[model samples]
Target: MRRVRQLAERTPADRERYVDLLRAVAITAVVLGHWTVAVVGYDAAGRPTGRSALPDLPWAYPLTWVAQVMPVFFVVGGFANAASLAARRARGGDAADWLLDRSARLVRPTTVLVLVLAAGALVARLAGVDPSTTRTVVWFATVPLWFLAAYLLVVPLTPLTYALHRRYGLAVPVVMAALVGLGDLARSTDHAGLALGNYLFGWLAVHQLGYVWYDARRKVGARFPPARGVGWTLLLGGLTVLVLLTTVGPYPVSMLNVPGEPLDNAAPPSLALLVLTITQLGLIMVLREPAERWLRRPGPWQAVIAVNAVVLTVFLWHLSAAILLVGGLDAVGLLPTPPVGSPAWLAWRVPWLLMLAVVLAALVAIFGPVEARAGRHRLPVKDAAPDGADRPSDARHQRHPLRAGLAVAGFVAVGAALVMNAVTPREAAEPLGLPVPALLAYLAGAGVLRVLRERPDTRGPTPPASPR
Candidate 1:
């Protein structure tokens, strides 16, 4: 509590608190939603089997639409990325320097997660556990990284995309939307190979909206009348499109991909999801005023900062906590897992979620500092006195060609590895050798980035920095 209070107090008065609030809310929803729907049970032989529990309820599909918060995350990411890039540019920073700064904060904590997963997989393999079980567990564990992979790929392109935002404004997202529509068409025709670009297009479009939000706010202030009513229209229009797509267009109503179902609204996000993003963006714009006012209070702002501090840790490990609890209890025959969608199961969700929260809190405590320490090194204020002037990080004014080249290679390797891993087949948590190449690539990238030239910049993230 003291630490949180201190964070609040330390925050610059001019900082935008609401962005952090949005990020916290979005991630919280994701964590809770996972706990709510994840159906972990035992097979006839007593091995763990899991899938989304939504189908059992029969009435929960519509709720999943409300619960799906991934779009909000990308929107927040876009805003932060645009702001961070602006700040970097204000102080003579280059594209590489800005990307390096952003990547380090993200990659460092992810390394810890990947390594932990690797060790767990190795242990499971040594136990003579079914390779299939191990493979399934590993794949399920890696599920969350899909977001990281896509976000990481997007980070490198901020310079280009931000340029498009500058040159074309709203047209950028609209064009991206059209491409998403095309991707959906290819998907409908079973041209899965050709539809791969939609993943990039879908997320980029949400992110582009953030750029729109940031630009509009800067230009017109948050109270702009035009932005407010867009929310209601988006809410209704998106809901209508969602209904038609599910009922009339072959897309699933559930935003999340349910196991045993052929439709996945998320994996290669469909056009319906784009409407959902528009709706989320609308809500965000409409709520900005009240949300910003509420966040201005010291206590609320402090909570937001504290949550953002360990947000990555919370995101990376929440599912791991749930998995451990479920697997451990099931192994000992102490788990009281009710039949899927049963009344008892519905009643048990409260305690189940509470237990997961407790465990996740502990995991955050253990791993969160890794991210916080790295964040403290963001670029410095553009100007400062020379007599022991405050510098943002411990960076020295030096550059290494070898280090820069290695950084390029490292990023490429990481991107390729994450993509390969995501597409690779894994049935029973058994991956060939427990090696996580992406973790290595990220570490390599971070080490190289650390050696790149560091410049001073206090233009800090539109004052409302969130992970992009």
Candidate 2:
């Protein structure tokens, strides 16, 4: 444990850019994937079917390779957890408080969003909309809520997870691999006794790998690249696993595809996912320097950073915007039913998707300010130390990365599990719950806001020197 602590402290602060860029890329992929899958359909009663029309697009399956970016989100999340924990520990703060503070920051905004959406759904139903259409809108609107639950489950378990990472080191991967293999075997034989553990054990395993990478970066610094030979080997290994699982393995390649079985890789995720994470991590490591360089550019990087700040808002509202656009357009008699799988039908969808983006942008423009206002109270202002004094003993300064990580894991695990059990029993306890991703997005948005608030603007005009 002492050795691990020392290693975690060695890396400088600027080494985190790669992970941030990776996060930006991952969120973008998710948005695009959702857009591609958006299609307008209706039942015989003239009500919207709330399903995608482009189900047969040749590019849909292959999109999974790039669009299934959730693993990368977890990896970056682990990195942020490590950094925050280490910062807090150095300031002499209690690990529990650090975790609690972060948890509140994540959960508060999400609760606001979910409650708002839920209320809207209820009102819509009372307006006499078809039951199926109302249900579809509500379900799609709540998709982003699953992240919140999943993340809350993981947040509280951070301490235990960090301890496991320290004690087991690379053995963490081995254990996760075993869980995946065992889960797969059980799933194959129609026994899902251990299936409930996949979200925690399986995906958490990948998050733990992010911890390993975080520790590794601290030891070697950002500029140090992995040997070319080793990098290619890991890359090839990840791709090989992905190919086998998608093509030959019982699982389908389309990460979005819903299987009939109780255990769906698209939902809670499976071991094959860790392979994808490993591959992504290796690829990031190989291009770390270049990626960092690219991200340093103000024009593009600023946009990336801006989007990162509002990623949660985007994820939670994108589907709602799409649904609204489709329903609104259909009411105006601008769209008519077309044969499925036809080029003409798909062409018609392009305009609606664009309109959806506009609606989403409008929502962001309006609600973004509201969310920011709410976020201000939820996130501790970085510049505002306790009593405005630079107390080293303050919680912000004394947080340890390992402890913070553990606290986060613990909070998320307990909170999400409880929420899932209460709301959606079948999907809640499993990976399909909305709590995890919502929690992550909430945390990330809060973290970014805190960092931005705390960080001094080095590029701005120089202030007059204070008299001594």
Candidate 3:
């Protein structure tokens, strides 16, 4: 608490506290939503199993419009990426340097998670756990990796995307929306594989809006937040389209994938999800003023900092925490098996979520420090040199195209491996109960990035600064 308070006190006055708040809220919603709706218990065969409860709860589908916070994450990522890139450029760093800086933070903590998962898998295998049980546990545990994979896929392209945002403004997302519609068409026509392209287009489009938010902040200054009218427009326009799509149009109402549904809106996103993004964006904007004001207080702001400090760690391991608890309880036969969505089940959620929160808190304590340390090294946008007087020489921070390409390849490999695990968890989590190929890919990616970090600049020596 003291550390959090001190850090909060040290934050730059100009920093957008609300962005951090938004990130914290989005991730929190994801964690709680997953925990609340989870159906984890032993099957009739006495094997541990789990699935989402949404399939059985048709009444809960509309709630997903509020619960699906992934788009908000992308939007926040976009804002942060744009700000960080601007700060990097202010320091005379090239896109490659910026990429290295950004990717390193994500990769380091994730490496810890990958190794831990693999080690646990090995233990489970050696302990003679049932193959199917191990596979099921591992699958549930690694479910969150999909978000990391998707985010990593977009991180490298920020420089180009940000450039496009500057050149084209709202047209960029408009075109992306059109492409998403086409992807939906392909999906409706049975080209599910081709429709996967929406993953990139849909997420990138939402991310582009973050750039718009940043521009609005810059244009209006910090005293006033972005216009509320814009928020209303997005809220109304998006909500109306979303209603139409789910009700009259072809898309399902649930923002998440419901098993046995012919069409899933989330896995390979859809035009409907894009529209949901618009609605969510407006909602956040509308709330931004009050949110920002509330965040101004030391108590609320400190809490936000605490959460943001370990946000990535919390996200990476929350599901694992839940799975661990479920396994332990199931082994002892203490696990409850209320019917899905029944009043008894709903009553059980209170304790279920409470216990999961306790376990997740422990996990965060163990792993969150690594991410916090990595974050400390990130370039601070608020503190960036406004006059560019402190900018480093290009010769000192040389851009290495080859090294950048290799780093990107490494990230791609890691992301692809993760996506494979997310898509086919049973197949990917094999042998020692871990996704060996994915683990190796992650290690290789981390190693390549490390080498990139250690490699010396070759663009010639930087001259010493003259005494001013």
Can you write out model 2's per-residue Cα lDDT over 317-342, one digit (the tens) per residue? Answer: 77778767777878898755566667
Cα lDDT of model 3 by residue, 266-375, tens digit: 88878888889889988987898888789889999989888887898999898999888987898888999889988999999999999999999999999989888767
Candidate 1 regions exceeding 4 Å error are 220-227, 377-409, 428-468
TM-score, one value per model: 0.86, 0.76, 0.92
What's the best-to-worst order under TM-score? 3, 1, 2
Against the hidden true structure, what lDDT does model 1 obtain?
Answer: 0.71
For candidate 3, the 10 contiguous residues with the lowest summed lDDT are 459-468
Worst 10 residues of 1 by lDDT: 382-391
lDDT of 1 by residue, 321-396 (tens): 8888887778788788688887988888898998999889889999999988777623122111121221224232
Which candidate leads the pack in TM-score? 3
CA lDDT, every prediction? Answer: 0.71, 0.59, 0.79
Model 3's alpha-carbon lDDT is 0.79
Best by lDDT: 3
Better of 1 and 2 by TM-score: 1
The TM-score that candidate 1 achieves is 0.86
- RMSD vs true structure, all candidates: 5.5, 9.7, 3.7
